[model samples]
Target chain A: MTDTVLATQAVREESPPRRGGGRNPLRHALLIALGVVMIYPLLWMLSSSVKPTEIIFRDPSLWPSSFDLGNYVEGWTALGAPFHQYLLNSAIIAVGCIVGNLLSCSLAAYAFARLEFRGRKLMFAAMLVTIMLPIHVLIVPQYVLFSQLDWINTFLPLIVPKFLATDAFFIFLMVQFIRTLPIELDEAARIDGCGHFRIYWRIIMPLCTPALATTAVFTFIWSWNDFFSQLIFLTDQDLYTVPVALRSFVDGQGATSWGPLFAMSIVGLAPIFGFFLAGQRYLTQGIATTGIK
Target chain B: MTEPDRSAPPGGALSLASPPTAPAPAAEAPPAARRRRGRRSQRAVRDGRVAYLFLAPWIVGMVVVTIWPIAASLYLSFTDYSLLRAPRWVGLDNFAEMLGDERLVSALGVTFTYVVVSVPLQLALALALAMLLDRGVRGLPFYRSVYYLPSLLAGSVSIAILWRQMFGTDGLFNDFLALFGVQGIGWVSHPDFALGTLVVLNVWTFGAPMVIFLAGLRQIPVMYYEAATVDGAGRWARFRHITIPLLTPIIFFNLVLQTIGAFQTFTQAFVVSGGTGGPSDATLFYTLYLYERGFGSFDMGYASALAWLLLVIVAALTGLNFLLAKRWVFYGD
Candidate 1:
């Protein structure tokens, strides 16, 4: 970042932009310093996950003298059940959400983006409004409703809403994506005697892969990391998702085992970390596109 | 619903609709043209039905999940609804209770401080770093990914746990302070500093805004900057005059989002303070208090009221920002 933007920006405005690629070591120093500060905690945690327990905090140097999987082994079974059970629970919810968002949201989005329908404008506006409605307002009533339906302590409450296309944000994202596809494609399909469902399944779905991937990845990550809802819905020890189980790690008496705690925390974050690495293009690009008008 | 509307006044509608246009479909046009017209109308009618079919899931979700719950939440706010028993209406009591609630006031204070202080700092860092990364730089991808990692992990319990220990008495922050011969207090436990640490934690995850700002900067046509440069505009002048005005919408977008998100922040405060929002209630965020009231104590009615208040505050602030944005947020058009 030496040739980066900062070049005594406040004082040297008159300096030619870039200074002919001159190395502004000072700018590199600043960014590097901040970057190190930004990542130090994570590095420390990663390092401690492998290091012995006695010197975990005694040495926060982000380097391990010993390569030990002992903490990981201990953390896995430290809870009554193995920690992977929580990971599995989180994965089940994530998979359900991903499938739900992809199927239901894309269908609704195709209608909004390509079809002519009565009440389309009104429905679109309603969907947008739900985007801003705080989840808190819906929480109490939803809890009550779910409890009445006998869905408490079950994944149904967490997973059912997605099947109904309740995650309006994804619908909006897919709508934006589908709208960008040429209308001629749909017209061409219609000329071939294809109906709306056929066109949605064949023409539009194939073209909206990026947007669909974005929705799927986001749903996976959000469901994987979801807290308040899961905390409320899941009470049984066998049903705990990664986030809830990790919180239990803190609330329980074994929280003092810092090494195991950090190890399990890292385990919990693994899938999300992997998804971020693999689908970062979708993640960042999706926000860039969806966030703007 | 759409299908019924198309046929509700069947004979009168078709007769009334057609006479003014064609007089008689059978007699007015050539056979091919008439067939095409008939097919097109059929297609139009089918579109309405197909639209509803496509929208079926969303309509159900909206009705059963969102709309009903919103209504129920409003109703619950005015009642004494405990899970163990039936709801008993007590109009205005929940709202009145909030007015006199000390912890609610303090919670509001804590929430506002977090929002006001953290959101701006986060956006400022985001924008500044965005500006830096906007210019052609080596290893841009590396830096972007490194920074964006936190935002991905920001809401996760893992990060929250990391944050707690990072600010604990023997945590890394204090250890850093130790290098300077400075005796560091337990930042997460100190009443005055608990919220501040959370503020810093919030700022640490400014990556999403940074990425969005970077994208918005890229969208500005290069011609604008070049034109400014030719006009003897210094870097400062170009940035201040050209960039700020153009990027206002993105800035406003990030501001509005960060503020709304900050108002609802739960995980960090919850995990940091061990779900107590403690250190003498110094870190008791509004949602944390709501969680305590609703789930911890089963004050469902009062909790609903608090939730509604949150909704109102978020809506008001967002609306106010939109109004304010007209003066500052410039559309490229």
Candidate 2:
């Protein structure tokens, strides 16, 4: 499975073809082609967004002969509310979710990781089991509960559960991260008369920037892309988030604006893709480190 | 309330690494230290209070959001509770009704087929791609990130909508098929192929399990392969002997997770089929059907019953996987 000899032979045979290159060029070319195919839809969407609406499906080529910038301009104002309003709405939810998850999940993780508490092991197991609890199981009653609170068509329903640490995945992620940190720090903090909360705030929190950032980035992206919960909770158009607003472009009663839909889709992906690029290192490292262990 | 004997060593998610060998024996304990040690019982009590204080949000959420909803749904499954009216007790009538409901049965059939087909294919693709990357390739990180991009977009509405467009009659895929002199039907619309397109879509996002497999691949010591090669093992021989057994744990994890995830697929089918699970219910995923019953037709009782049924199925399948795992999943002691 290691292919050690093949690697060594490739290094020897391919080195003269190109200095510092040991991998087979054919394999590189093949993988590059496959990568392009993997990302083709994204490229197709980008190209289609600039093509004339009438000719979008008519012309299947990725490169358009003529550029029509109307899609971005029209899609922005196409829906009843301008695109920025939806962006702002999504931003609010994303930020709220990140803050909620970071504070509550880290607090819970600290308790699970460091503090010796009653029923700690059982509580931890309960949380882990709930990780597999299907969201479908909760939707009806949650919807009913929110409706009874008169929170239908409101951001509160979409955002409040996040604040209460409803996502156990992040809690588990943080617990894994905290476990990797040495326990002696907490012991030393205690020797200096720092209470559990103080050690958590002053010591563990400072050392947990990477894990917290992972939690924040993931929460932001997940909330930003969340469609079902937002679709169900926010019925009014004016309060629509990005995903909800984007859905409206397709779900319009009349002709669908394929051009604008693609255009807005690209626009919607910008921030998330940007965040992913910025946080890619931590994201990959975090998953690679914790997922195996 | 007591210290709970930390000397016994903690367990669960936190203690993947064994608890630190009971603190090195104290060589220079004084009376002042002994007095402080006597206060350790008080400290455990204090930690308990502090732990609950920190855990208040999760505790409250588990009750109100999770436990209550699960309990209520279990009850509502047995009672007719439309939003406008109080629930009327019906006992096992909903489950009995399920026996006769063709759509519910078809939905289960659809869901089962999806799980059975998608999980293995996805895992195989993931393992294949992971092996490709594991070959010590150049620029592997870039390749990994690009490949992983799709998994990140897996459940996004935009991607589903894009998939719908790409599989439409005049879409990119059909156009590409025309180049091959093959006539292609509307993939997302044709009853025969709508589920197939969803299956392909599910398989296409194999990056997640691929990554997990890569991580697992890294865990296998290279020395084993060196030893195998020294014994005259070839590529296939080494893979069969050294890789498969060691990687089974990760494979099992991916299998269980992906199976559960495939069973709950909603947004893609919902978006592709325009939230109706249409084209004669060919694309009617289980969750989509549940949504249709619960919110669409307001058959809350039936939907609640379906929800419980799904939970039971998932639990049983997961339990089954665990039981079977003992036979196949190799843990290096």
Off by over 4 Å in 1: A1-24, B1-42
Which candidate number maximizes DockQ?
1
DockQ for each model: 0.37, 0.35
Tell how far residue B43 is off in model 1, in angstroms: 4.0
**TM-score, candidate number 1:** 0.90
Clashing pairs in 2: none
Q: How many residue pairs clash in each candidate?
A: 0, 0
Which 10-residue window in model 2 chain A sums to the lowest lDDT?
A1-10
Per-model CA lDDT versus the true structure: 0.81, 0.80
Quality of candidate 2 docking, DockQ: 0.35
On the 0 to 100 scale, the lDDT of residue B139 in model 1 is: 62
Q: Tell me chain A's TM-score in each of the predictions.
A: 0.90, 0.88
- TM-score for candidate 2, residues paired by index: 0.90
**Candidate 2 segments exceeding 4 Å error:** A1-22, A253-256, A289-293, B1-40
- Candidate 1 lDDT over A1-293, as tens digits, reads 11011111211222124423234667667778888889888889988988877788889787798889999998899777788898888889999989998999999999888775555666787887787777777889999999999999999999999989998888887887786689999899989989888999999999989888888888888898889899999999999998998898877843477888888888888898899888987887677655521
lDDT of 2 by residue, A1-293 (tens): 12211221222232122223338798788778878888898889889999978998878888888998899998899989899999999999899888899998999999898876556766788887887778898888888889899999888987788878899988887787787789999889899999888999999999989889888878877898788788778989889999888777777722357888888888888888888898876666555533311
